[model samples]
Target: MSDTSSRIAIVTGASGGIGKAVAERLAADGLSVLVHYSGNAATAAETVAAITAAGGKATAFGGDVADEDAMGRLFQHAIDTFGGVDVVVNSAGIMPLAPVVDTDLDTFDRIQRTNVRGTFVVSQLAARTVRPGGAIINFSTSIMKLQMPTYGAYAMSKGAVEGLTLILAREMRGKDITVNAVAPGPTATPLFFEGKPQEVIDHIAGLNPMQRLGTPQDIAEVTAFLAGPGRWVNGQVLYTNGGAA
Candidate 1:
């Protein structure tokens, strides 16, 4: 890690789960993190505290990822506080499972608004504001390849993220910036088992070759590598799923 004291990173959905892990990882890697939470102020504070406690710099901010004005302020906050942003990690997403036919329009629209459009807005802003050698790491899911039942809508949303990451990589060619996506398989996050029973959760843990559910730390390590030393990798979705894919 370089000085990165002035190198800011915006991590959406940073209040918990994968987002929180990625934010902490980036902070430990020396980036000044802008922890973005949608509605959980208390959790956001905890994330900021963890970063600062580790002697890393961080600040918590709240805003709707789907709102353009909110994204503008998010970007502005990073610039105003840390001088400029060098990384943008689009980790805010919701996964509500239902068969395609049974999936209501409202749920479908909500997923798209946050997963696809939110990534677009944030990536667009990053393209304009991020300095040379910056990185934009978008989140996707291995389920897109698995095509599991009841995951059609959710996969569709993450599929859009995969597309955006690839295109944005080429779009930023010659700018010394890299755009990439990381897809984790069956991670053991609170969001992953929201309503599932213990047995269901246990089943998922065994699905991966490692015989365990993926951890947020596993995904965060890959993300940090991409955001830093792995800059040579571009427009690719690195699957860190215990060979499940």
Candidate 2:
């Protein structure tokens, strides 16, 4: 383990949406954050600006999450900039909705490349590089349990994430590091709202006991918990949906 006083975190997909929320929350928790984004450099800079303006340390880094070499460089950047890494949140992913039969193979492959392969690449590097007592969090979705139509491809990717979360925790037995996945349901991020009708959105929201869409902050709270004091809660998939699944 590195110095406990200078903890650092790397949050992929930190440009906007849930990733941005998690980055800000973790920065508020006193860890210097490396904000990773694939594109949209300007949005990523905005995230960093928000963090820094609020007396937190943050830097924007650009890279393709599924590219092993790029992700490796991202890890190196974190170490070079922040001294060492204590937490890694693999929140970079894409969700393309379509029924299994209707989904194109190209679309299926793209989803897997970003979500499944991306998580695996990041998790592997995190396992090799993170200091003992650190945490690695991957994103999944509660919709997997809901078995909603037009989500087969996305759900399949997240299911693989759940599996990876459990196995990685076991693989890190003696390291004192925790590996887990956060499965959110119908969060009202740009990603969630894209291409969906208001009626569809309302219908989905009504399924949850809360009867409302979750905000990015809601999910960020859980990420912050797992990254910090929630050390005992390892090898688990925490469903952050409001009684929807």
Candidate 3:
């Protein structure tokens, strides 16, 4: 990490949803943010604008999360633009669903590439770049424990994310940087509701003791804590699921 006065963060997939919320929340916590998006420049711009309007520092960068060169540049952009990166949040992923038997190989590969490989790419860069006393957060899903039938490949990829989170935390032994995965259950994000019907959504929401779907802000709060003051809470997967499992 480059030496800088202000704490800085790079949030991938920050154009909208939980990523956007986390970016904003971290900015509110006084970190300069680099909001990263895969393709949605307009939405990414909106996130940046919102942050700036709130008197927080932020910039938007566009790149494929799974591309090494692209992600390297994304990390470099934070160094050049924000001085250095103190935190990195890997929240960019795809969640297409299908039972294991019915899922096509291409779809499975795509999910792994984005969710698992993408996290690996960003985590690699973060491991090399994040400042001491920083954090690296990757997103998992509570559905893995729920064992929903159609979530086979998605859950498999996040299982790999959990493995990466723990291994990376240990690998960072003396670095003073914490690594953890946040497993959220039934959040009301665009990705979560894309093709599902209201009844299906309702059913999933009811599985949680809270009897309500999570908002992006709910997960963002957990992320903000991890990125800021939760230093002792490393190498764990926080299930922010309202007792769903």
- Please write out the lDDT profile of model 1 over residues 1-245, one tens digit for every residue: 35666678999999999999999999998899999999999999999999999999999989988888999999999889889989999999898888999999999999999888988988899899889988999999999877789899889888889998899899998998999999988898888988888998897777777899889999999999988889679999998898888
Candidates sorted by lDDT, best first: 2, 3, 1
Q: Model 3, residue 96: displacement in angstroms?
A: 0.5
The C-alpha TM-scores of every prediction are 0.97, 0.97, 0.97
Model 3 spans with C-alpha error above 4 angstroms: 1-5
lDDT by residue (1-52, candidate 2, tens digit) is 3233489999999999999999999999889999999989999999999999
* 1 or 2, greater by lDDT: 2
The sequence of per-residue lDDT tens digits that candidate 3 reaches over residues 1-245 is: 23323999999999999999999998887889999999899999999999999999999999998999999999999999978889999999999988889999999999999999999999999999998889999999998888888999999999999999999999999999999999999899999999999999999888788999999999999998899878899999999988898
State residue 205's C-alpha deviation in candidate 2, in Å: 1.1
Q: Please list all clashing residue pairs in model 3, or write none if there are none.
A: none
lDDT of 2 at 201: 95
lDDT of each: 0.90, 0.93, 0.93
TM value for model 2: 0.97
